[model samples]
Target: MTSLTTTQRQIVESDLGQCITHEKLLGEGWSNTVSCINNKWVARFPHTPESTQVAVEKQFLYAFGKGSPINLPNLKQTEGNYCLYPLLDGKRLNLEEAAKLSHQEKQKACHQLGEFLSWLHTSSFTDENLSTAPYGEADFYQDLWQYVAEALPCDLRLKAEAYLDSYFTTVPDEERKPVICHGDLGLNNILWDNSNAISSIIDFTDLFLCDPAYDFNAFYSYFGQKWVNMMSETYTPHIGDHFWQRVTFNKLRKALFVVYYARHFGYESYIPGRIESIKESLSQQLI
Candidate 1:
């Protein structure tokens, strides 16, 4: 549990039209502070006044999430600093929790996730402002390596550079047009219900246009190639020849970014796990 500041408490009270008798911290992310109010409502407050994430997420949810096959946050109120929504009932499907599921349960969850991704990728959103380039581009990776290489261990650093060199040389151009992606679809963002099914997909702050393969990176990182193959069984979009290669690249890139930024942003706890992931990716020849 986390304590709220006086201002945050006041904001929640004012928005809900009632006093907050019970409030529990849900989690904090790079951009937002989330809390559950009275076990019924979830409130998200941005970390900075300059952020447009609250507004952008509110707009996307209101405009596109109504008919979604999976449960999405139903925002109840929105202000410049914060937003509130009905708490979707579930626990975050983190790696440990997912490992507890039976094989049958995993299959069901994957199928549901596949169907949801199919719906999301195929559905059209014609907002050019939301369009952004894929994260796996050569220039972006080069810049990222430059920024974080000094902090990485010597062996890991060499491996990362070698991987990037190989990736850029063999990587294909953008053959598939961009589509709206959840941006960060890691297990932390997925929810599991008591019945062992995916209850909802939450945290749309990173939503934007990018390669379809970018969406599968988190899944592959968390659950491995076999699990991702299960997900692909129901994922309807045409898989490009280079799709899996891009996914592996995105996974490594995401881990590096997390490790460096976690330290830069003073989130020390996130660094160790990400460092291990980077090491594992290199050792397993995931690139």
Candidate 2:
């Protein structure tokens, strides 16, 4: 049997909202059903059972946005299975959108995002008022390596594991800077308003900490080398030079992550693409 399409998901969302008339099917994301709710609100709900994730996206939105200068999505309310995200005037903000903006606007947006991430990483996450997990720097990478070793093809997977081991072996644990990290940070997940500014960050499922470089991995993937120099200039003026190594590590680690997900999820189509990305990382970072 085929899985539910966007139309079926719209029905489910309409049922949840109890709307009289269902409107357009806005877009279908990697794991969620997205549709117009009451022609005003956009309702995003998980389509697959494995989709509900560890990171508390809604919780992060509430906590992270409290005093943030950059805007994240404002949470409206939650029904049983769906979350209501307020409508923004932004369009699809993949790297393609950056080209439409002038260099100055791009510069402003990059700086704003850099500052936002800097604050997120510097801010501590404790269990005082919120229910959370304890994370250590080495623990995060160890877990990542384990996941990759189990997920990728035996040959590629073993090589990647050894690569990680050698990289960390020379580095002392005490030298690692611990900070909160956005487990997943990239262009597809960011939204920009009509004015060419990032208006909302939609997904918050992959929240964790190991290195802030993990956050900037998206730069190489989506925005291309064209963005690297500009991004470095914008961030260094504030946070200092601490994230590049982590970013390089993150780039390689994430390529392994792609293989891991494909193996576990049985998404055959992803394997080829992931292998290609992994090869790219090996050529670039393994030297």
Candidate 3:
């Protein structure tokens, strides 16, 4: 577990206007070191001293999050490279828990997620500079390959390279419009309440502008086509001709990235499952 520095402790104390009574490390990801303070607030400190993701997340939450159907982080204070917000009341809705849901429960989860995505994708933003197209660039995959290739098994490496090559050459639809996306909408970021509902969506660090289909990729990867269909029923937007194609690509890409992340971040337990997911994904023809 990553420990909080003395400076960070001081910052938290300064923000709360008192000495800490309780503190717990929630998670430490590539972007931020997260902790629960006093069981009332969540503190996120950027790993990179130069990172501006904390401030950007704060701006986005305050700007577009107010009208959201789902709860978003309410930032209490931001200073230096850290930000503090009230801790949301719920546990992470992991894959095991999600699998246990009944049909009705699954449908409800789909509805809430679908509605939230609809609202997010439809939200207007004038500053095009605020949006980034990291995934759309071939260089991004090239860089990712450099980090992930050596970690993959020999059999998987060949397939992974081929996929990256194909993705690099493939041209995206020019007519597709970009939307504000929850760039990292995996299971870990979704908070589920005791009432069996999605309580909140957290971690907006990878938030960016991209194809709306990118948002559905995680759901497809997690729950398969049936769950995606259920969610699509409630989503207001018309599905584009190439929507599922992009979703398929995103799913495969993310699965590979998970392998790399697991190896790099000391989460080796994730590697086997992700490798299986990669094999399953590679076996299918790209849509």
Candidate 4:
């Protein structure tokens, strides 16, 4: 466990009104340093001013507390750039553990997750201060395609360009209505119970309003097409045909986003695998 800064220590002491008896680093991600404090609370420190995750917890998370189908964090400190919450129970599901689940188990998890997402998307939780999504269909395709064009080898780039041409002409923003999105619904952020059902969905740092299909991107990336199809079958009645098209767009955008940042961050080794995945996701027809 890393030592807590004096500021962090004081923040906890001030908030909890007790000395910490135990502390340890729980995990670190792109924007926040998460630590367990006194074996009961999670202290999250944002390393960058751009990390408005603390604000997300303060502004948005509480509204989802009672009615939300899955567990959400209950904030302990609400008035600062750093946030503290009760330590949530459950293990984060890794790829190996996820793969080990039986088909019935997988379907059960997918079904439950699907139902939770359906409620999240349809919920009347609104905040005027919440940010709009960074990309619309046209912009998502165009910007990410440019990133793909510059990053990929010529052969792959050509195929990506062809897919982009089709997407730009076929799917426009007017065709799809926006809904609130979880922003970064990656596997690492999802917590699972011993029975393999989802216990909690964490990290609302990237929350915004966008196509509901964007929420399915992480599920597709980790679970594959069949799993996505299963989840979609349940959600489709709410969204209709534009749902799969948005899913394809979101998948491609995520891939290009990975490549774009990987190159920017000099993570060259990741580009090849990400590029292949990009190609595969792009090959799907805009449903």
Candidate 4, residues 1-287, lDDT tens digits: the string is: 76578877887888899998899998876557889988899888876645454575567777666577788888774566777889899888788888888888888878767877887778676775555533232355454567666655676667766766776677766545677778788778888888888888887766777777778988877777888877765563366656676777777666676666566545778778887776565555322
Cα distance off (Å), candidate 1, residue 186? 2.2
Candidate 1 Cα outliers beyond 4 Å, as residue runs? 126-139, 151-162, 268-273
- What local distance difference test score does each model get? 0.76, 0.60, 0.75, 0.72
Which segments of candidate 3 are over 4 A away from where they belong? 126-141, 145-172, 256-280, 284-287
For model 2, what is the alpha-carbon lDDT of residue 164?
68
For 63-103, candidate 3 gives per-residue lDDT tens digits of 77778999988877456667788889888867888999989
Whole-structure CA lDDT of model 3 = 0.75
| lDDT: worst 10-residue window of model 2 | 128-137
- For model 4, name the residue pairs that clash: none
For model 3, name the residue pairs that clash.
none
Model 4 misplacement above 4 A: 133-143, 172-175, 259-287
Give residue 28's error in model 1 in angstroms: 3.1
Q: For residues 23-94, could you state the per-residue lDDT of candidate 2 as single tens digits?
A: 566776655656665566666666544433423556666666566666666765453345566666566665
Q: In candidate 1, which residue pairs get closer than 3 Å at backbone N, Cα or C atoms, i.e. clash?
A: none
